[model samples]
Every structure is written in C-alpha cells, then in structure tokens.
Target: MTELVDIHSRTPKRRANEAMMAKIGKLIWALLLLSGFTRAATAGVLTGELDNPSGTLDDQFVYTLSIQGSFDGSPEFPKVDGLDVAVGGKSQNVSIINGKYSHEVQIQFILSPQKAGNFAIPPIKLTVDGKAMETLPLELLVSASGSPRLPPSASGRSGAGAGAGAGAGAQAQGDTPGLFIERKFSKNTAYVGEAIGVNVKVFSRIKVVGAQKDFRYPSVFQVKDKDNQKSNVEVVNGQEYNVTELESVIIANREGEFTIDPAILIARVAVQRRSRSRSFFDDLLGPTDLQEKRLRSESQTLKVLPLPTAGRRKDYSGLVGAFKLSGDLNPRESKVGDTLNLSLILEGQGSSSGMADPTLPFDTKLAKVYKDKADYHEELDAARGIDSTKTFRYAIVPERSGPLNLGQVTIQVFNPLIATYEDLKFDMGTVQIEASGAVTSAPLSSASTPTAGDTAPAADTALPKPEQKAVEVMAKDLVEPHSQSQLRGSDIITSSDWTNGGLALSLSLIGLVSTGVLAYRRKPETENARMQRANKAFKHSKKHLDFAQQCLRKQDLPQALKAAQTCFKDYTGAKFGVTSASVTLRDMESYLRSRSVSRETLHELREVWSALDQMIYAPPLGQNPTRGEELLTKSRRVLEQMERQCGRS
Candidate 1:
C-alpha cells in the first residue's frame, strides 16, 4: 500500500520533467534551422556545367562556370593541355525572391579537343566580396569514329522514355537528322550572255529560334533579280523544317568553267531542360539556354559557252537576245529651216546593262542632224522577266529637201533560242520640204556639205560665194593747240554753286518721299492672306501626286508609295492648319467627319491610305505593277475630293 502511494506521488513530477525536456529539444531544433537558413542566405555558391559531356574530336563543346552571389570581379578560367579553350561571353542575372536578394554571373568557354581522349578541366577560381570561391571540376570524353551525343534535354527529349526511344533510333540509323544547306542552279550550262538562275536553300529539321546566313557568288558573274528570295516552312524526307531560299539571276560575262563556293549558315537553337524537383527559390531563378550550330553546303560548277560567231551581222551591237527597232519622224514634211524631231526606240529581252546606243546612218548632206543623249529605261516584269527600252531623239534641219530619204536604223542581236543572229531594221520614208526665203539668214557655217557618196546638186543651183570689199587709205595732220590759260574765278564759282543749299534741300526732300513710298508699298500680311497661303496645300499635294505618278510610270515602287503617302498627309495637315508630323490617321478621320465627308469616300480613302502606308513601311514581295497604278488613281481621286471640300468650306 505504501509503494502504490509513492508511485502515484512521483507520477505528476515525472510527467512535468518529461514535458520540460521536450520543450527544450523543440527550442534547440528551431535554433538550428534558423542558423542554417541565415548561413545559406549569406553564403555564395559556385558551380560548373558542360553543354555536352561526350562529343567527337571534330565537335566543340561549351563549358560554363556559374557563380551565385556578390563577386569582386570576373572569374579566372583555368586552361587544360591538348585542348583549345576560347572565352565565349558572360551574362549576369539578379532577382529578389521571398525577401531575399540573389545574383548570378555565368562565364562561358568554348572547348575544342585537339586529340581524341578523356580530358579534365580544372576548377576555376574567383574573388567574391573579399572571399575566395572556386567552381567544381568537369570532365569530357571525345571520340574519333563516332558522332557527338548531346544530352537528352539538348536533343529535345522530355524524359527517360523519350531518351530510350532516341537511343534506339540512333542505333538503328547510326545518326540523327541535322541542319544542312543545298545550293543548285536552274541550268548547269548557259550561253556567255544568257542569264542563269541560282538558288541557295537552307533546310533544318531542328527547331531554330534565330539564324544568320552568309552567301557569296562568284565575282566574275553579274547578279540580278535578287528581290525574289523567299523564307518559309517546308517538309522534306518526312520531317518538318524551316527553309530559306535565295534566288538570283547570274550572267557570265565570259565563256569559261567556274565553281561556286559553298554557303555558310549559323543558327541558334533553343534547348529545353528536363524538369526536376525544385524549391520556390529555384523555380524563380532558373536559366534559359541556347545552342549554336554552323552548317555549310556543297559547291556547284557551271559551264558557260561562248556565243556563236557565225551569221553575225555588221550592226551587231554586242547584244545577246531577241530585239526590235522602230523609228518615227514628228514632221514628215517641213520647211528648209524648220527643225524636225526624230525618235528611235530599241526594245528587247536582254539585260539593259549591256545595251548600247544604236548606230544611225543619217545622210548629213540632206539635213543637219543634232543627236541628243539617249534615255535608257529598264524594268523587271513578272511575266516577261527583264525588259529594257532605249529612246534616242534627234533634231534635223533640211537644207533643201525633195523626196529625201533618211537612212534606215538597224540593230543586231544574237537570239539564244533561235541559235542565230537577227537584224532588226526600221526604214525612214521620204520627207518633203518647202522653200524658206530666209535661207540667206541661216548661218553659213551651220550648212551641211555633201559627203563623198552624196547625190550631186542640180546644174541650176547657185552656191553662195564669199564677198570681198576694198577700202581707201587717208592721213590727216594735227591742228595747232590753243594757248594755255588759268581758270577764271567766276567759272569755278559756277561749278561749285550746284553743291549749295538748294541741292541739299532737294536731296533731303527726295529721301523723305522715297522713305514714305517704301513704307506704303510694304503692307502688313492679313489673316485672309495667311489662310489662302495655307490652302495652297491642295496644289502642293497635287504636285506630290504628279511625282508619284511619274515614279509609277518608271516602275519605282518604293518612291511611288512614299510620294503617295506624303500627298495625303500634307493635304490633311494643310486643310486642318496642323503640322503634318503631328497629324495621325485618327485626326484625319475626325476632320473628315466634321466636314461631313461621305461614308463611301471615307472608306475608299482609308483603304487607299492604309495600302499606301503598308507599301511605304514594308513593301510586298512580287509586287504587281497594276497595284501601284491603282493606288495612284485612288490617291488622285481622294485628293481631288479633299480639294473640293476645302473650297466649299
């Protein structure tokens, strides 16, 4: 009974002791966790990683050292023997997470193996906030016979299952599809002056986030038609890819065999990492990585054959294509001294760069021909390829004409399709001339004399002869000089009298009258005149529209679009008395609505103006010439409506 009572008495004390010990243990654990968190918050971390741990000797891998925390300066990278190490670049990132600030500095190095073997990259040392820090060492294995193997994440595989599938596929095929380029010509053989199309295409099965290309053709050939290049997505060999195609017209100037060098393309591909268990801090501070790849295409050879020399004509202007020649005389019949305008046009399919002025065999004795500079216009037509036309103007004055025939104009060219030389000619018919009584008034030196083979003159015709005149000579003796005498006082006084009070008074009166007249002539500009001057924007806009039309006729699409846009902006600004630079499309809309512009007119104006703005900012590919013409017409109509509305206002 005493033992039971003692046990009951000790129970409460034992229970209290146990509770106190448990409280003490909990406090100690809390202190430990807090201490650990504070250390982590203050401490810095350094780590090293590899882009690909295993690769071939021909392949290059990236080695990166990342330091997280405050650092004194940049880290010092260590070197390894039998390896080429180059500094790539550096990047820094800063973030504040959960009330804690963190910073990360990453240094990248490109490692190229000189020989096939296992290499060890030593730790990199860095100074961080007056403390020493070092990155962990890394290892790389390079082989000579096998292809490089990228990490599963870098290879775009998600997990172990995907990695296994990739491994099995690689075992089956020995390699994976990669980026490549293909270059080819439309024709392997072409004539010396014929244009051959060349295409450079880049095909890649891998996902490319960014890319740059360097393409070069032989300098010996002339390049044309470069604006036809294209970029888009395509599928090849049952795999999707991004394809960029570059098209150019190449013309070989000389006959020879030439080889085109390979083109290089570099692409930066995004690499997605496999997901891993992370804390809230890590989720907020992860890195995004990208891989770069360089690819090249095979060279191409071309054979340029010389143009045929057989059946070549005398008037062959070194042009190689089908061509046509035409001529027109403004006035077929004119007086002796009247000037006649003659126009000769040469049009063809050959490159205009090689086209020269056509030679004219004019009869100088019949007329004085003054040739002007030839104007050459070339345009690229979507349907007809490249077409060029050259116009030459001549002013002819007939000395004496009756059924006189101006010689024929001829142009020779080699037609590659027909495999022969062609002679294009235009015969100038007879031109009649009436007698001008002012023949004698014409300059004698301006007359054209007959050439060696010119027709003989009529027997009754009289030629002008030089006139000679004789002059009589005579001599006269000098008369006796008058005696010298002193000037009289009265004569001196008379000469000085003009400078007296009367002259001064007259000059002052003239000055006052002139000042008043000048002041009266200079009138102050009124508000009405200012408004009228502002309204001149209509005329200015018309001038811009005219310029746009001229550019459209010349096939200058960029300039035409720019001028058209300027026309509308200037007209709107001037009509509203606002600066053109400050006027937006919305402002124009408001102004038009206030003026009670028709809905149809506003809609048409919006369409035309939007099209013009788009063309000015980003020109469309393969632009049809008709589009420019239509835009020009619409712009003219809108400007006219605005002008009429302004007049009404």
Candidate 2:
C-alpha cells in the first residue's frame, strides 16, 4: 500500500538499489555472530518491536517479530489491551555461505486502537533453543478523534515556529478534507529591487498517492531560483500532518500593494477501498482507491515600498542586500602594453539579477581598460536563504611603465536587514610595471618644423633657459590706476535703446495674450465627466480585444491570454478612472469598494479578471476556441456592465 504523500513536497525517487539490501545482509550476518549463532542448525533467537509507538484512532500501526539463525514452531503472539491485533504479513529468508546455512523469519501484525486512550503492551514470552525469553514492554498513546498529540521532542516546536500548519494556510484555507497551505515570508514589506525570502508549504492529515501543485504570484512579484522542497511530519496543535515546504525569493518589479493568490495543489488522496465483505488478503495489502483533491491557500498582500532616497550613495546600483566585494588582479608585475586580467567578485546574500556593472575609474594616460560582461550564478542552500555571485572581468593594457592603479572600485548596497548602506571596496594592490617593449618617438625643433613666428637660436649662441617665476602681490586685489577716467562718458544710454525696448515690450505682451487664449481654449470642457463617457472607453478596449482575437486565431495561446488580460485591465482602469497601469483586479476592488461600487459590479469585474489571470499562467490543455471566445465575450460584457452602472440611477 502507498503511504500518504504530498505532491508539492519533495519526494525522493526510489531506485532498484540492491546496494542497500547488500549492506542490510551484512548487518544481519553481524547480528547473527553477536547473538552467538553457531549455524542454521542452531535454534533461532527472537526479537520483537512495534513499527510505531503510537497512531491516531483512524490510523493503523504495525508490529514485527523476527527470529535470526533458525526456529521451531511459530512463536506465540501476545494480546494488547484496548487494541485489535491481526496478522498483517509474514516473510522468511535463507542463505548458504561456504556450505553453512543461515535463515531468518519475520511476522508482522497490524495493531488498530479500538478507542482513543493510553495502552501498555506486556512483554511476549517465547522459547528459543528451549530457553524462556521475553521482549521489553512498550507504551502507546492514541488521542481521541480530533488533532494529533505528541511529546515536545518529536514535535520540534522550538525551531519550527509558533503554529504548526500556521501562516497562509490556516487563515482562510483550513477547510474540509483536513488540508491546509502556509506561506512564511521574511518580511511582508520590502523596498523595490529588494529580495524577500518566502517559504511555501502544504500540510495535510490524509495520506496521498500523487499530487501536482502550482503557485501564482502577482504580476508585480518576480519569483526566482526556487529551492528544492523538503517533506516532514509536523504536529500542529494536536493534529499530525505531513508537511512539504520549499524556499523562494521574490523581487517586486514595481512599487504597489498587490494581492497574491493562494498556492494551489492538485493531489490524488488515498481512501480505503470498500467491498461487501473483507478478505484476509486485503488486510496486508491495504487495498485503496485514489481520489483527487484541489486545495488553494488564502490570498495575501505584499506591500512593496519604494527605495529610500535619503543618504543614498552615488555608486549605488539599486542592489538591496548584504554584499561583499573582492577583486583578483593577475600578473602583479608586467611590462607596459601587456594585457592583464582583472576579476572582481561581488557576492551577496540577496539577489543581484539585472544588476549593472560597476564603473571603474580608468586613467586614459596610464592604461586602457576594456570591461568584459559580468558572470553571475547562485548557490542553493536551505538554511541560508539566497546566495549569489556577480563577477566583473576586465582586460587592462598598460600604456606606460610605472606604478599601476585601477583606482577605487566600490559597490554600494543597501542592507534591508539593517536598514543601512555599505560601500564595498575592492583592494587593487600596487602593481609594478617594466618599460615598454616597443616604442620610438621624438620631438621636432622650431627650426626644423614650420614655426609660427618663433626663431631658433644658433647652436653656439648658448641662450639661457627661460624660467617661470611667481610674483607676490601687496594685496589680494588692486584697481587699475586710471580706471576713473576710462569709464567716464562712453556708458550713457541713447534714444535708440528706448525705442527698441518699448517695441519689444509691446510684442511680448501681445504674444502672452495669444498664448493664454490658446491654452484656455485647449482645456477639456467636460473635465469632470464619468469614465464611461471618456474618449478611450469602449473603442480603446475594442482594439485590444481585436488584437487578442487575432492572437487566438493564430494559435498563440500565451500571447492571446496576455492580450485579453490587458484588455480587461485597461478597460476597467479607464472605467474606474484609475490612472496607474499597475493596478490589478484586487487593486481595483479596493479602489472601487471605497467609492461605494455595487457588489454585483465588483463581482463581475473579478470574474473576468480571475479567468484571464488563471488562463495566462495555466499550462496548455490543447488548442481550443471555447476558452478564448468565452474570455472575449465576458470581457466585452463586463465593459458594458460598467457602462450601464456608470450614470444610471
């Protein structure tokens, strides 16, 4: 029989691994020697244990009795208080090594608790080689049919969290079928370009055979590099559940309050197969049937705040997280004109996706540096959310031989955790360079070159070299001596200036009057008109709808769905007088709810919105016109509904 499983959780693929069975064979042989087994001819030893110490009222546990070496008649089984025990299965194995035979037998018994209470099973007495032997006693606790209960250690309550099955699941998702989903976010609020750590989980009480799951985030949130899911048994409140969880990082591409849809799971649950009468074979095999269940979590809102403008650094490249910067410069010592490799590794705990390259200060006279594109990759770790590295490589060709410097390479990052900015600097150690390998250049004298009114001196004249000298002034500033006489009469205004100034002022006033009239005439006459009466209402939405239909006809499902969603969003935004293009259906709901919009209108709006949204991300089922046509007709109808509700009393 298949055990309970979550399709959303990570399931280790079981392989035909005889290697593990070989190791178990070795272990069994070691146990034989430890128990003083002479050979298969010797009487076998007996050992017994319960598969699980406790189980729910609706659950069934197992106990196994094993004998090593060899055995006589079947060992007697024991009766437990307040529990029904039945033979679940039986098996045996024999091996002959170097003509010495060894054999083992195992008996499995199914223990079903009759009622919810504590029960103690007394040790079972058995005869091995005609000697009396008794196994140790055991205890089990079965809680009443409600939630599961366990001791503190098994619950792992300390680190897991306050609530078992808490978070996004239990809020609005704890419905029938004993299944729930949870989403743990590092922070509900984050800045733009900031990476938010998210863990999506599903908790279920019922065992499932197979399941498929998908999570749809708002268009504004970009989910990236999801971690491998892990499955575990978690006890929440008193109920036990098989919980599957995974880690992911989301970056808000735009700043807004967007509603995130719940995580969805489609699983095939295992239920007991019914028959008129039960058979013994059904007891061990546990025949069951698979029933599909669709589970969705509660919706949430992620508030993406804009990046802070205060105390921002000039070198900041919109990187929001803790980061470290280090550089590697190859060949510390080289000659001028030699190309050198410089690798700068910028690693951090947050996402560096779409991060621009750092600006390196290159001295044109010293070396011409060419920047190679950055290489980036992320490491996968469950404990530490996200770790990524962005490396910038550069090729430097020296123009002169001297002490070389690449200047200060600093990358500024905003640590959202600490709400602080860090300037990461790369240390470019002093690089010594040898003289140029090839170079030849000489200056031309004034006599040899065509001089510009400058004569060259004779070789024997031996003229003294000119020296630049600095002179100190008596005061910081001194007026020219004859300045009073030079400024006396030439600065007077004439009659021509007065004439030109008056004419210019008249023309400027005339132009101002004409401009004001034009502006007044161009102003919208019906500025306060309803959205339905606006110019871009039905006709504008029609264009988008037409494009969507064309896309659907061409069998471009994704593009068709996208175009349809756009048509709805644009028409709704325009009808509600929403100017921002980023507002989604949920956003519109809140916006309209505040203005006393009717529930019917809101419902209609949501119906169209959700259908388009689900279809856009949904995997292709086939090329079908029903879905596309229905969406187009529904979108058009919603626009009309808004029109009717616009001004009618």
Candidate 3:
C-alpha cells in the first residue's frame, strides 16, 4: 500500500512538469512573432508613378505615391526638397493592417507640355522606423492627340484571342470613369431687381469616401447669397456633393459682360478598394492588397451675357434684377387734417436688395408729410448671396388740394442678372382732394353750461375738470371687459365715504400692518443683511447677464433677449414688487400716469422700453453699440424722472 501511494505522487509531479513546459513554449512563440513584426516595421518601401499621356491638352491625369514601412520609432512623411506643386498637390496618412504598416500620399498637377518631348518623374525616398526606402523613377512618352503608333484595337480578334479577351474583361471590372464639372447662369436677360442665379457643380464616377480636409471655394468671384444662402448639400442619384449659387443683381453699371467666376472643389480620394477577407483569423493575420487610382474633375466655365439695351431708358440707373413692388394708401380719400396712409413695398433680387432704401417723391405744394416708417428684409444663399425687400410707410396730410400727383418714386439699382442699368418708377397715380372747411363755434354766454353737442373752447378755469372728464371717457372707451371691472371698482371706492371717519380708521389699521414690512425693506439695520441682499441680487443679475451676453455674441438673439428680460424681472422681484414677466411698458405708463408723472418723462420711459424690445426682437442695425448707448441714456433719464416722481405717489 505504501509503494502504491508513492507511485501516485510521482505521477502527479511528472504531469505538472509537462504542463509547465507547454506554457514556456507558448511564451517563446509569442516573443518570436512580436520580434518579426518589429523587424518588418523597419523596412520602408516607397512607390510613385507619373501620368501616362492621354494626348489631349484638357485631359487630367492623377499621380499617386505610396510608402509602406514600420516606424519602429516615431515616423513622418519625407519632405519634398525642390518641387513647386500645382493646385491639389500633397496628401498623406499612416495606415496599419495585420503586421504591416504604411504611410500613403497623393498629389495633382495640371500638365501642359511646351512641345512634344520625353519627360521623367524623379525618384522619391520614404523613411519608416528609421530606415529609408527608395521608389523607382517614372518615365513617360508624350505624344500628339492624333497619333499612329498606338496599341491595336479589339477589332482584330480570332479563336486564339481568348486569353487577351479574358484580360480585357478583368481590366474592365477594375476601370474607373473620369470626372466633369460645369458652371451655369440662369438668364442673360433681366429687368431691375432680377436675380441672376449662378451655379457650380462637379460630377465624378470615382468612388470617393470623403475629402481629406474641407475644400475651399474660389475667392475672386463674389457671391450674392449673403448669410450663407446660395449654398446647398444633397445626395442625388447615389452621389454626394455640395453646390453654391449666387443671385447677383442686374445693375446696368457698365452694361457689359460682368463675369462671376465659378467656385472650384478639388479633392483627393483613395483609389483602391478594400478587399474582403476569408475568415476572422485571416483578417487578423493576412496581408491586404494595396493598389491606387487617380481622378480629377474638368475645369468649370461660366458665361454672363449683358442685358439687352434695345429698349433701355436713360434714367435706368443700372438696377438689374427681379423684384416685386407693393404699395397701399391709408385713406385713399380724406378731408383736410385727416391723415393719408401710404405704404410701398419693393422686394427683389439685386445688389441693392438690402443696400438701397426706396424713396417716394411727393408734391409739397399739395400735401404736408408728417412721419415715415421703413423696414428691410433680406435672404442670403451660401454665405454671400442676398435677396431682399424693403417697405416704407408715410402719413401725408393734404395742405391744399385739387388733384395731387405723387409724381414718381424712382428706385435705382444695378441688375447683375440683366447686365443692364434699370430703374423702378412708381407713380402715386393721382389723388383727388376737396378742402375741409374750418370748424367754427357759436359764442356762448353761460356761467356753467354743458351740452351733449358742446364745441366750445376749454376755458382756463374749467381746464382741470374737463381734462379729468376726458381721461375718464378715454379710459372707458379703451379698456377691455376685465379691466373695466377693475375701473368700476376703483370708481366706486373713490366715491365712497372713506374720506371721512372710515378713512381715518382704515389708515390706522394699514399703518400698523405695513410698519414691519416697511422696516424690513428699509436700509438694513445689520451689516449682514445689506451685504446679503446686494450680493444675492448682484450674483443673480450677473449670472443672467453673462449668459445673455454669450447668447448675443453667438447670435442666438432669442435666448439672449429672454435672458435680459429675466435678469430685469429677477432683480426687480428681489428688490421690489415688480416681476419682469408680469410687468410691461403699459403697466409702467399707467402707474406713472396715476402718480401724476410728467408727460415728457412718461414718453421717454416708454420709448426706452419700446426701443429695447425692438432691438432685441427685430432685425438689427450695423452698430449695436449705438443702439445700446441710446437705450442706456433713455433708461437713466427715465429712472431719474421716476425717482423724482416716486415721492409724489
């Protein structure tokens, strides 16, 4: 039994030794594989080729260079020493597959030989993992477009041509089609305010994954699509591309061909397609076939024809583009002192779309102009093309009239579309007017007499009472149903006997209840109280204002505006009873009016708030600071006026 136990222990020890040996063998194998990969990295191999002449001057050929090596250490592309590259010259990236690593690069050149001759592309060297690899030199034969020594065409075939036919079939499967580009103009004829649409497009049959970097469009040509209009991206017919269009105004500036150049897109794409592997293990251990192809798009050309001058006008003013003119009269017919509403709309495509404000000519002998309002709207394409409209409104009162003529409101613009000078002459047609006789009143001799049809001039002694009556009437006429309820209640309370003993009792009770509130709201008795309130208000306002400023800087006008409004409301709610969201200009006006604030002060305050709201929500002018300063001045003046008037309330 003892001998059996000894045998069992000996057997276990032998098995353990065998297992340890197997593990050590695996470690050795792993180390050897790693060393092989490391050695392979040090071998840098570079490859390059020259364009095979296609015999056509316009035909573009692509040249690709690839370098494969292991950067056992840090590696970068070898810098070219003495070569002036053409348009799209160099692109490079490091790639690794299986145990092999490579750095790939490409370039483009527009080649036009001075004369038919032999040419050679110089050899290039690649550095990988500290070792240099030299690429073979490329030689090319330059030939005329119509040459005779070319290879035989497939027209001559026979029973023994099977091998050649198969080779041709294989080549066809790997062949790539070339690229084409074109530029187009919408029209050569246009009137003033017409949009001259221009488009640039690129077409290619080569499979392109993406651009190495963003492609920059040409700069010499200006795009009328301001604000990034006239630009679009679309996938059409299984192809992806970006297009830019410009709508230039047809201004008859020079009445000649005004050529706008096309924006070009040059891209570098991988020529070889990635092949499929047999299995997961093959994918991890096999070498990938490396091949390359080159392609380029044809250069684009655009023709801008000048607008016709056959029926042109001398006062054309060179405004060429498409547009619509709209106008309206407030009171087509009115009595003297009655205001006439005049609105005109000029919207269209052109250089002056957003830059020009239309002016209306009026006859001062027949009418007196009071006030005018104008606004502009513009739309842009790509980042440069612009389409715009402008509207003007005016209040004109007939001073003395029989038949008043608005003459002609002439709008001048350069039409880039028609390539001619043009003008828009809008006639106010003709307005018929009759005199409104003066309003006369009969003499009255009563001490105190009031009538429903009374038209007497307000006397000095009764001015206050009559003004009060007018205010009451205006309030009743303008207020809504809900507000009317509140007004009625106020009226009832004011007419009650609260001015007598009841008022005294009520005042005593109110004073007792407000004593604590007034004290709490007063200048702090404790240092911490004042500091805490000021600090809280400051922090809240500053945080909101900072966010508002950021949004404004980003042109997120809506959010910036909301933040500004919130800041004011927050500050007021914390310091006073007014919440910004709940308060409005009208509310302030009513409060000031009740407190007997001066009309000038109230008007200024309303104007300040209204201007701020307009600037925040509406289209902005070029200088925001100017508008801001105006707002600040008005705000300060209104606040000072409010403080002076606060004591009175």
User: What lDDT score belongs to each candidate, Candidate 1 first?
Assistant: 0.68, 0.67, 0.49
Q: Per-residue CA lDDT of candidate 3, range 1-649, in tens?
A: 9999999879978999999999999999999998987776555555665444343322334445554544343222232332223433454455566756545434334344444445565665656546666667665455543332221222432222212211021111111233333333444443333444443333345434322111122332333423232345434334443433222322232323343322332334345422221224335544332222222222233333455666565555444556556677756666766788887777775544334344457757678876565787776532123467677777888887577777678765555534544566676777777768775443555745777787776586554432233334434457445653466543655535656768889889999889978878674665455445534654565567578667666756556556655654554444333455786666666665776779998777666665567555442212243345445445545555655664411
lDDT for predicted candidate 2 compared with the true structure: 0.67
Regions of candidate 3 where Cα sits further than 4 Å from its true position? 1-44, 49-65, 70-118, 125-133, 139-179, 187-195, 204-223, 226-252, 255-263, 268-318, 321-326, 346-362, 370-390, 401-438, 441-649
lDDT of 3: 0.49
- lDDT tens digits by residue: candidate 1, 1-649: 9999999989989999999999999999989987876666566877788877876664667777777767776566677887998787676666655545566777778787899889998988877655787767888888873343421112442321222211121210011145555555656776788766555555556666655554566767876645554677755434555666655567788898997765555556555432221235446544355555545554567888898878876666787766788888878878888998989888787665655666557678888988888888765532233577888888888898576678787777888768788888888877888887655545546246677887777777757566877775575666555433544445344545767867899999999999998777664444455576567878888899899888888988779888988887888877776788777778887887888877777888887987776556431322434567888998999878867765732
Q: TM-score of every model?
A: 0.49, 0.44, 0.42
In angstroms, the error of model 1 at 615 is 24
> How high is the lDDT of residue 359 in model 3?
46
Off by over 4 Å in 2: 1-178, 225-227, 237-240, 275-287, 313-315, 380-385, 438-649
The candidate maximizing lDDT is 1
Residue-level lDDT for 256 in candidate 1? 88
Please provide, for model 2 over 1-649, each residue's C-alpha lDDT reduced to its tens digit, 9 standing for 90 to 100: 1345553233443333466778899999998775654544465566777655765564455566766544457765677777888775576545545545555566766677889888887777776656667667878777653342321222343335444322222231322245556666666677787777667666677776655556778878777646356778767657677777766777787888978776666555665543322334456566454444445555677788877778796767788878999888989998988988999898988778678887777576788888898899986443344689999898988888888876778778888878877788877776788887566444557555646676666788755555768886769647665644466675655689899999999999999999999888766653446533454666787788789889878878668777777876676567666664787777777866665778998898887877676666443212234556887888777767665555331
Instruction: Give the worst 10-residue stretch by lDDT in candidate 2.
Output: 166-175
